[model samples]
Target: MTGKTHIVGGIAASLAYAQIGNHDPLIMLGAGIIGALLPDICHGGSKIGRKLPLLSKLINMLFGHRTLTHSLLFLVIVAWLLNSFIPNEAVKAGILAGMVSHYLLDMATKNGIKLLFPIQMTVRFPLTTKTGSKVESIVFSLLTLVSFYYGFESLGYYL
Candidate 1:
């Protein structure tokens, strides 16, 4: 999935999380976006990857794409780190929501991610699509609408 799609998924997840958790929509959205792009750090062409070219290259070379960074272990470690370092529950939840969204989106791709890394297990959905394909674009658009609707709905509660 593209970064934009991940971002939309993250926002949608944030909105969904906001419905059940006590958090500011804006903060959740911001954290969610960051989390969504975090997993793609191994791909040099990704949004976050482009920003840190050297780190991205190193990760890509050392681990390859969709390996350690996209694994459940990575998510667990990240969650642990966030829990230990961040005092805000809502913030941690929002970030985790985004990361989970990232994983789900990648799971829909043809080349599924090694969700359980070091175990050589790939978790994928029944239906899959190619990355950056027209189908993904449609998914991106639909998720955008969903995100907008939910985002507005979520904001109404705080407003």
Candidate 2:
């Protein structure tokens, strides 16, 4: 999936989670965006990676794309760190939700992801699509619609 797709997925995931948990949607929005793009830091060409080139290069060199960052180990460490550092429940939950959405979206791609890591096992959905392809565009559209729906729903707008 592309960065835009991940971003929309993050928004949709975060809003849905916020609504379900009765959290503040506003707080979740920004955190969700950050978390969604965090996993792609291993790819130097990613949105977050472009912003932090040196760190991106280092991570990519050390672990390669979709290796360490996309793994459960990274999620565990991030969860621990967020729990320790972030006092806002909404922010933490939003970030984690967004990251999970990222994992799910990437898993739908043909390249898949190393969810288990160290084990070298690739995890993906039964159906997959090429990154940035027409199928991905449709997925992006669906996520956008979901985001809009959740966005309004979280704001107490029932339409």
* Highest TM-score scorer: 2
Q: What is the lDDT of residue 94 in candidate 1?
A: 82
Candidate 1 local lDDT, residue 153: 81
Error of 1 at 96 (Å): 0.9
Q: Give candidate 1 misplaced runs (Cα > 4 Å).
A: none
Instruction: For candidate 1, write residues 74-97 as lDDT tens digits.
Output: 999999999999998778888888
Model 1: lowest-lDDT 10 consecutive positions = 150-159
Per-model TM-score versus the true fold: 0.94, 0.96
lDDT of 2: 0.92
Q: Give model 1 RMSD, 1 decimal.
A: 1.2
**RMSD each, Å:** 1.2, 1.7
Model 1, TM vs. native: 0.94
Model 2 RMSD in angstroms: 1.7
* Per-residue alpha-carbon lDDT of candidate 2 for residues 61-94, written as tens digits (9 for 90 to 100): 9989998999899999999999999899999998
